[model samples]
Target chain A: MKRSLKQFRYETAESLHIALFQIRANKIRSFLTALGVIIGIVAITMMGTAINGIDRGFDKSLAMLGYDVIYVQKSSWSTMGQWWRYRNRADLKTSYTEAINRTIEDNPNSNLLVAVPQMSTYQASVQYRDLTIEQAFALGTSYRYPQTASGDLSSGRFFTPTESAAGTMVAVIGDDIATGLFGEREAVGNIIKMKNSRFRVIGVFRKQGKFLGLFSFDNQVIMPLGAFEKTFGKKGFVTLRVKIRDQKQVDDAKAELLGIMRRIRRLPPQKEADFSINEQKAFKSQLDPIKNGIAAAGIFITGMSLFVGAIGIMNITFVSVKERTREIGLRKALGARRNTILMQFLIESVMICLIGGLIGLVTSFLMTWAIATALPDFPVQFSPALVFASLVVSVATGIISGLAPAVNASRLDPADSLRYE
Target chain B: METSPVITMRDLKRHYSMGEETVKALDGVDLEFLKNDYAAIMGPSGSGKSTLMNIIGCLDTPTSGTYILNGQNVAEMDDDELARVRNREIGFVFQTFNLLPRINCLRNVELPLIYAGVNPREREERATEALNRVGLGDRITHKPTELSGGQIQRVAIARALINNPSIILADEPTGNLDTATSQDIMEIFSDLSKAGNTIILITHEEDIALYTRRIIRLRDGRIESDKKQ
Candidate 1:
C-alpha cells in the first residue's frame, strides 16, 4: 500500500508537469478556452456585489427611519401601491399624538415612550431671492420630533417648546435645502419664502442619502405643526411617530400601540382598527421578493455562460486527446496506468479554470472599484466570500467538463494507438 | 547446469473479429527463452510477428494460452498488473524511437522509473548512467528534435535499459534509420547483449537478423523455422 501511494504521488506530479507544459505550448488555445470561464465568473461576482450593495443600502435607509420608532398612518407601508383599501378609511388625525402621549403617561407599564405628530407634502416650493426649489418635502412636527428620527443637526438647534406652541414663523432646513437657498452663506438667521409666508431658518440637518434610492431625506423643510398649518393648511397627510422603550421588544410595543389607537378612534373590539401601524420591517418584507428575483435571474445567466465555457474546455480536451494518441500509447507502454492519463487531462482543464477565475475576480474588483469611484451613490460592494465562492465554482466546472474527455483518453487501446500515424 | 527460462509460452492463440470474418492473428504456438538469450523473430507482412511482439512485451493479452515472463503469469494478469509487468520486466524500443519531442533526453529515459515510483534523485542518477552506457551522456538535456536519428534511438535504448528490465524488446528499431545509422544502433544492441541483457529483435531484414545468435522465422501465423548460428 505504501508503495502504491508513492507511485500515485509520483504519477500525479508527472501529470501536473505535463499539464503545465501542454497549456504553455498552446497558450492562445488555452486562453480562448478560459475566456468563457472568465466571463461567467465576472457575471457571478458582479451580480453578488450588486446584491450585497442593495442589501447594505436598504439597511442604511431603514436605519434613517429609526429602528425604535413605529408610525401610525392611514396607508400601510408594506402594501403601499394598493391605496383603494385604505382610501375609504378615515384619515389619521394629528391630534392622535396628544391622545397617545396621554395614554402612555397614564399607564406606568406602557411599552410606548412618546408620540410626535408629523404632517407632510411633496409639492411644497421654497424660494430665496430669485432661486426656487420645487418638489421639496415640507413637514410639520413638534420639538420632540428629533427623538423618533435619525440625523443630528449640523448647525443651530431644534425649535424650542415655546416657539412650537406659539406658532412662530421659524424652520429647520435639510442640507439640500440650505445649500440650494444659501449656497456658501450660513443658513441660520436667513429668511426663506414658502408660498406667501416668510420663515426664518433656525437649524440645518446633516446630509442623509436617499431612502432605498427613492426619497431623499436631504430635501425636506421641517417646522412646528402650528406654523405648517398656517402655511399649508391642515389638509396635509398625518402620521403619528411613536418611540418605543426597546427596539427588540417592538412586537409588544406595537400591540400596545394598537390598543391605544383603537381606544383613541373609539372603535369596538370586534371592528378592525381603521389606521395601519408600520415599521422598517414592512419595507424589508416588501422588497425581499424583488431582491430574490434579481438574484435568481443573475444565477441563470451566469450558469449559461459557465455552461458554454465548460463545453469549450471539453471540446479542446477532446481535440488534445485525439492529437496525442501516440503519446498516450507511448506512455502506456512505458507503464503509466489509466488513472495517470486521466489525471493529466483533468489537471490541465482545472488549471485553466482556476486561472480564469482569478482573472475574473480581479476584473470584477476593478469594475466595482470603478463603479464606486465614478458614482459614489451607486451601490456596489465586493466581499471575500464572493472571491471564495467563484474559485470553488471554477474548480467544480473544470472537473465536470474534463471528466468525459479524460476518461476517453485513459481508455485508449495502447497497441492500436501505437500503430496510429 | 540448467537454468529456468526467463519467458515461457504454451499454446498461445489470439483471434480478432473483422466485421463478418474471424482473423486468426496468432494460432497455437509454444516457445521459451532462457536468461541472456539474444534472438530475432523474422517474418513477412501479416505473419503475426507484430502480435507476437505485443504479447511478449505485455501490451496485449492472448485469447487462449499461457505466457510466463520472469516467473509471473502475464496471460491471466489484468490491465494494471500487465502494466506493472511491462514496467519491471520488459523494455520496448519502437520503430520510430518514440521519444517525446518536447522533453529532454534525460526525462525521456526516466519515464519507466517514474512509473516504478523511483525517487527523482535516484531516477536521474540511473537515467544518466543508462544514457552514458548508450554513448549519449553529453546530450542529457537535448530534446529528441535536436538529436540525430541514431542519437534518438540511443536515447530510447537508454530509456529501455534504465529500469534494468528482464528483456529488451526491439520492434523494427532500425526501420526508420538509414543503413549507416541502423548499423550504429545494431552495434549498441550487440554491446548490450554482450553485457548480459536478454534481447529480442523483430525484423524482416536479413542483415539485422544475421547479427543475433538465434533466428526464428514465421509464415502465416505459424513458426516456419528456427536456427542457431
Candidate 2:
C-alpha cells in the first residue's frame, strides 16, 4: 500500500509536468479557454466588493445618526416619500420637548435621558458681504443640541444657557458654511447675514461629510431656537430629538415617548398616533429591501458567468482529450494507471482556471483603486475572504467541468487509442 | 538443468463482437516461452499476429483461456492488475517510437520508472544510464521533436528497458525507420537478448525475423509454423 501511494505521488508529479508542457505548447488555446474563467472571476469579485462597500458605507452613515437618539416627527423615515399620508396631520410642536423632558424627570425608571427641540428648513440662505450661499440647512435648537448630535467644534464653544435664553444672534456654523464665507481664514467673531439679520459666528463645527449619503451635514447653520424663529418664522418644520439612556432599550423608549405624545395631543385609544416616532433603525429597515435586491441581482449575474465559464472549460477539455488520444495510449502502455490519465487532464484544467482567477483578482484590485480615487464617497472594498472564496470557486469549477473528459480519457482502450490516427 | 517457462498459455482465445458478428482475433492457440527466449511472430494481412502480441503484452485480456506471465494469471487479471503486471513484468516498444514530443529524452525514458514508483533522483540516474546504454547519453536533454527518428526510437527503447522487465515486446519497432536505423535497433535488441532478457518481436519482414533465433508464423488467428531459424 505504501509503495502504491508513493507510485501515485510520482505519477501525479509527472502528470503536472506534462500538463504544464501541454499548456505552454498550446498557449493560445489554453488562454482562450481561460478567458471564460477570467471574466467570471472578475464579475464575482467585483460584485462581492460592491456588496461589501454598500454595507460599510451604510454603517458609517448610520453611525452619524447617533444610535442612542430617537426622533419625534410628523413623517416616518421608513415610510418616507409617501408624504400625502402625513401631510394632513398636525405639525409637531417644539415645546413637545419640554413636555417629554418633564415626564422623563418625573419617573425615576424612565429610559429617556433628555429631549432637545430642532426646527429646520433646507431653504435658508447665508451671506457674507458679496458672497451668498443658497439652500443651506438652518437648524434651531436648545443649548443641549450637541448632546444629541455628532460634530466636534473645530473652533469655538456652543451657545451658553444665557445666550439661548436671550435668543442671542450667536451661531456655531458648520464647517462648509464657515469655509464658504471665510475661505481658509477664521470665521469666529465674524458676522454673517442669515435671512436679512446678522449673526456672529461663535463656533465652527468640524466637517462631518454627508448625512445618509444624500445631503451635506457640514453645510448646516445652528443657532438658538429663538434666533431661528425670529428669522425663518416659528413654523418651518419641527423634530424633537430625544436621547435614551441605553441604545438597546430604544424600542421601550419609543413606546414611552409615544404614550407621552398621545396624552399631549389629547388622542384616545381608537386613533393611530398622528406623529411618527423615528430612529436610525427605521432607516436601516427601509434600506434592507433595497440592499437585498442588489445582492440578489449580483448573485444571479455571478452564477450565470461562472456557469458559462464551466461549460467553456468542459468543451475545451474534451478537445484536449481528443487531441492527445495517442499520448494517452502511450502512457497506458508505459504502465500508467487509469487514475493517472484522469489526474493529468484534471490538473491541466485546474491550472488554467487558477491562473485566470489570479489575473482577474489583480484586475479587480486595480478597478477598485480607480473607483476609490475617482469617487471617494463611493465605497469599493476587496477583502481577503473574497480572495480565498474566488480561488476555491475557480478550482471547483475546473474539477466540475473537467470530470467527464478526464473520465473518458481514463477509460479509453489502450490498443484502440494506440491505433487512433 | 531445466528451468520453468517464463510464459505459459493454453487454448488462448480473444473474441470481439462487431454488431451481429463475432470476430475471433485469437483462436485456441497454446504456446510456451522459456526465460531468455528470443522470437519473432510473422503473419500476412488479416492474420492474428498483432492480436497475439497485444494479448502477450497484457494490453488485452484473453477470452476462455489460461495465460500466465512469470507465474501470474494474466487472463483472469483485472485492468489494474494487468497494468501492474505490465509495469513490473513487460516492456513495450512500439513501431511509431511514441515518445511524448514535448518532453526531453531523459523525461521520456523515465516514464516507466515513474509508474514503477521510483524516486526522482533514482529515476533520473537509471534513465541516464539507459540512454547511455542506447548510445544517446549526451542527447538526453533533446526533445523528441529535436531528435531524428532513430534517436527517438532509441529513447523509446530506453524507456522500455527502464523497469528491467521479464519480457521485451517490440511490435515492428523498426517499421518506420530506414534500413541502417533498423540494423542499429536490431543490434540493440541482439545485445539485450544476449544479456539474458526474453524478447518478442512482431513483424512481417523476413530480414527482421531472421535477426531472431526462432520464428512463429500465424494465419487466420492460428499458428501455421514454429521453426528454429
Candidate 3:
C-alpha cells in the first residue's frame, strides 16, 4: 500500500520525537545551538514593541489638542515671537479678530463659541511685594481665555467675557504663579503687582506639569484682553481662538472664520491667505518617515540574527548526519526508502528550530512586558504580528538548514550503506 | 510444503579492483537454496564467505551473473527495486546487533515495518508479537544499554522477524556473545527453522556450523564443499 500523507506526518512526528530525545540526552549542546535564535527574537520583538509604544504616545499627545480644533495665527505654525517679523506689516490685531468673530456669529450655520484674541510677550523678573520670579511670560487674553485653553482650575472662578469687555483688572493665576506670589497661602482675591499695575487674582489654576523644567502652563496668570489693551496700549497683534459647539463642527467653524477673515482682509480671488491655519494631525503625519526608517532597521538587524541561527542549525544538523551514518545505513538496509530517510533528518532539524523559536518567543514577550511596565509613558505595545513573524522566521531557518542534511540522507546507497561499518 | 529453490544463482562473479589488480570475491559460483532450509556458509579469512552472504542478502550486487531469488531476476533490478525487494523479503541480523541507540527495543523492532508503510497500530501489534517470540516481550521498553549482550541480540532477532520476511540472514549473529550466549542464539535459530522460516548463517566456528542442517564451505573464491549434516 502506498503510504498516505498521514503516514508521512506520523513518520515526521516520530522523527521529531527522536530528535528531541537526542537533544534531551545532550542538554548543553542543544541549549548552545538555540542561543543565537533566542537573542535574535529578543532584539526584534523588543525593538518593534518600543517603536509601537512611541507611535501610540505621539497620537495620544496629539489627541490632547482636540481633533476639532484649528489654530489661526499671524505666522504659520504656533511659535513664540514670530509676529515680530510681521510687526511692521499689519499684525492680526483685535479689530480684525472682532470683525471675523462678529461675522461668523451672525451666520446661520455659526457654531462659534466665545472667540478670544490672545497675545504674549516675554519678560524676566516680575515681582510681587518682596518675591520675584524670573522669565515670566506676560499673556494678554480675553476673559474667555480659560474656555479656549482648558487649564484645570484648582480654586476660584475664571474671568468672564463681560469682565474682559469692561477691561476689569482681575487675574486668574496658574498654580506656580499663585505659589510664588502667596507662598502657599490663599492668593485668590489678592492683589499682585505686574508691570507697575495692580491686578486682583480671582482664581488659582492647578499644576500644568513641567515643560523642559522652565515652568508649567499652570505657572502663568490670566487677565481680561481689554484690561491688557487698556494698560499696555491697543497696538499689539492678536491670534484668534474660537471654540466650536462640538468637535464635529470644528471644520465648519474654521471654514466660516476663514471666509470672514478673507473678506475683512480683502485679499483678491486666487490669492492665498497671508496667515496659516495649522492642525495637530499635520505634525503626526511628519513622524511617518522616522517610523518607517526605524521599522526597516529593526527588520534588517533581526533578519541577520535569524540567518545566524539558521547557520547554527545547518552546522548542527551536518554533525548529526555524520554521527548517525551507521544507523541510517542500518535503517535503509532494513527497508527504509530514500524519502523516509530524508524526512527523518528533516524533522529533526525542524524540531530543533521549533524548540529554539518557542523559547525565544516567550523570552521576548516577557522582556517587552517588563520594559513597558518599568517605563509608563514611553510606549511599548507588544504586538502579535511580531510574535508570529518570529515563528515564521524560525521555521524558515530550520527548513534552510535541514535541506542539506536531508539530501545527504536520501542520497545514501542502500547497498553500500548496509556495509558502511 | 518444501518445494522449489527460493534462491538460485548462476556463475555469480563479484569482483573488486585494488588500484591496478582485479580480485574476484565470488568467481563463477552456482548455488541454490530451497525454502525452510537452515544452512551455514563457513570459510577462513579471505575465503569470500562474507561476499557470498552479502549477495544472497541483497545488500550488494554481483559484478556479473544471474541472481534469481523467489523466481525474480534481481540481478537485472535497479538499486531502488532491489531495496524494495530486500525490505519486503529479507531479514538481516548483524554481528553487532545494530539496534538504534536512542530508541527502545519495541521501536527498534518497529523500524522495518515503519519503512514498509505499516500503520502504527498494526506495526505495534506485530512488533510486540515478534518481541514476545524472541523472549524479550517484558523488556520491550528497555534500551540496549539496560540489556545484556544476549538480550540485545534477541531484540535484533525480533527486529529482523518483525516484517515476516522470506529469510533470516545472520552474519555471525553470535560473534559478540560468549559460548553460552552463542549456544542460546543458535538454539533460537534452530527453533526458527523448525517453525518453517529459512535461516542462512555465516560463521567460521565448526561448533556453530554444526547446528545447521546444511553447510557450504568456501576456499579462496571457490566452493570447496557442500554437505548436509
Candidate 4:
C-alpha cells in the first residue's frame, strides 16, 4: 500500500510536469482553449459581485431605517405600489406615540422601549438669503427622535424637550441642506425661511448616502412637530417610530404593537385595524423577489457561458488525446498504468482551466475597480468568497470536461497504438 | 550450457475476430528462453512474430495455453498485473525508437523506472548510467529531435536497460535505421548480451538475425524452424 501510494504521488507529479510542458509547447492552442473558461469565470464573478453589491447596498439602506425601530403608518411598505388598499384608511396620528409610551411604561416586561412621532413632506423648499433649494425633505419629530433614527449631529444639538414643548421654530438640517443653504458658512444660529415661516438652524446632520439609490437622507430639514404644524399644517403624512428593546425580538414587539394599535384604534373584535406596523424587514421582503429574479437570470446566462467553455475544453482535450496516441502507447509500454494516462489528460485540462480562472478573476477585478473608480455610487463589490467559488467552479468544469477524453486515452490498445502511423 | 528458463511458453494460441472470420494470429507456439539467451525471431509479413512479441512483452494476452516469465504467469494476469509484470520483468524497444520528442534524453530513458515507482534521484542516477553504457552519456539533456537516428535508437536501448529487466524485447529495433546505424545499434545489443542480459530481436532482415546466437523462423502462424547459430 505504501509503495502504491508513493507510485501514485510520483505519477501525479510526472503528469503535472507533462501537462505544463504540453501547455507551454502548444501555447496558442492552450490559450484559445482557456479563453472559453476565462470568459465563463469573468461572467460568473462579475454577476456574483453585482449580486453582492446589491445585497450590501440594501443592507446599508436598511441600516439607515434603523434595525431596532418599527413604524406605524397608514400604508404597508411591502405593498407600497398598491396604495389604494390604504387610501380610505384613517391616517396614523402622531398622538399614538404618547399612548404607546404609556402602555410600555405600564408593562415592565414589554418588548417596547420608547416611541417617537415623525411628520414629513418631500415637496418642501427651503430659502436662505438669495438662494432657494427646492424639493428638500422637511421632517417634524420630538426631542427623543435621535433614539429611533440613524444619523449623528455634526454640529450643534437637537432641540431640547422644553423647546420641543414650547413649539420653538428651530430646525436641524441634513449635510446637503446645510452645505447648500450655508455654503462654507456656519449653519447653526442662522435663520432659514420655509413656506414663509422663519426657523433658526440649531444643528446639522453628518452626510448619509442615498437609500437604495432612491431617497436621499442627507437632504432633509428636521424641526419640532409643533413648528412643522405651524409651517406646513397638520395634514402631512404621520409615522410613529417605535424603538424596540431588542432587535432580535422584533417579531414579538411587532405583535405587541399590533395589539396596542388595535386597542388604540378601538376596533371591534372582527373589524381590522386601520394602521400598518412596518419594519425594515418589510422592505427586504418586498425587494427579495426582484433581487432573486436578477440573480437567477444572471446565473442562467453565466451558466450557459460556462457550459460552452466546458465543451470547448472537452473538444480540445479529445483532439489532444488523438494527437498523442503514440505517446500514450509509449507510456503504457513503459509500464504506466491505465490511471496514469487518465490523470495526465485530466491534469492538463485542469491546469488550463485554473489558469483561465485566475486570469478571469484578475480581469473582473480590474473591471470592477475601474467601474467603482468611474462611478463611486454604483454598487460593485469583489469579495474573497467569490474568488474561492469561481476557482472551485473552474476545477469542477475541468474535471467534468476532461473525464470522457481522459478515459478514452487510458483505454487505448497499446499494441495497436504503437503500430499506428 | 544448461540454464534455468527465464521464460516458458506451452502451446500458446492467440485468435482474433475479423468481422465474420476468425484469424488465428498465433497457433500452437511452444518456446523457451534460458537465462541470458540472445535470440532473434524471423518471419514474413503475415507471420505471427509480432503477436508472439506482444504476448512475450505482456502487451497482449494469449487466447489459450500458459506462458510464464520470471516464474509469474503472464497468460492469466489482468491488465494492471500485466503492466506490473512488464515494468518489472520486460523492457521493450520499438522500431521507430519512440522517444517522446519534446523531452530530453535523460527523461526519456527514465520513463520505465518512473512506472516502476523509482525515486527521481535514483531514476536519474540509473538512467544516466544506462545512457553512459549506450555511449550517449554526454547527450543527456539533448532532445530526440536534436539526436541522430542511431543516437535516438541508443537512447531507446538505454531506456530498455534502465529497469534491469529479466528480458529485453526489441521489435524491429533497427527497422527505421540505415545499414550503418543498424550495425551500431546491433553492436550495443551485442555488448549488452555479452554483459549477461537476455535479449530478443524481431526482424525480417537475415543479416540482423545473424547477429543473435539462435534464430527462430515462422511461417503463417506457426514456427517453421528453430536453429542455433
Q: Model 3, residue A185: displacement in angstroms?
A: 10
TM-score of each: 0.98, 0.98, 0.81, 0.96
**Alpha carbon deviation, residue A66, candidate 4 (Å):** 1.2
Worst 10 residues of 1 chain B by lDDT: B1-10
**Docking level for model 2:** high
| Tens-digit lDDT string for candidate 2 (A1-421) | 9998999899889878887888898899888888888888899899999989988888888888899999999999989899999999999899988998899999999999999999999999999999999999999999999999987999989999888878899888889998899999999999999987899999998888886689888999999999999999998799999999999999899999999999999999999999999999888898889889988998898889888988999999999899889999888888888988899999988988988888889989899989999999997899999999999989998899899999999999888888899
Model 4: CA > 4 A from native: A106-109
lDDT against true structure, model 4: 0.94
Q: Report how far residue A297 has shifted in candidate 1, in Å.
A: 1.1
Which CAPRI tier for candidate 1?
A: medium
**RMSD for each of the candidates:** 1.3, 1.3, 4.9, 1.8
- For each candidate, give the TM-score of chain B: 0.98, 0.98, 0.98, 0.98
Instruction: Point out where model 1 deviates above 4 Å.
Output: none
What lDDT is reached at residue A298 by model 3?
86
Which stretch of 10 consecutive residues in model 3 chain A shows the poorest summed lDDT?
A207-216
Q: B21-74 in candidate 3: lDDT tens per residue? A: 999888988888899988999999999988888888887789998999898888
Predictions in order: lDDT: 0.94, 0.91, 0.79, 0.94
- Model 2 residue A284 lDDT score: 82
**Per-residue lDDT over B87-149 for candidate 2, one digit per residue giving the tens place of the 0 to 100 score:** 889899999888888789999999888998999999999999999999999999999999999
lDDT of 4 by residue, A1-421 (tens): 8889889988999999999999999999999999999999999999999999999999999999999999999999988989888999988889989999999999999999999999999989999999999999999999999999999999999999988888899999999999998889999999999998999999999999999999999999999999999999999899999999999999999999999999999988899878899999998998899899999998998899999999999999999999999999889889998999999999999999999999999999999999999999899999999999999999999999999999999999888888887
Better of 1 and 2 by DockQ: 2
For residue A85, give model 2's deviation from the true position in Å.
1.9
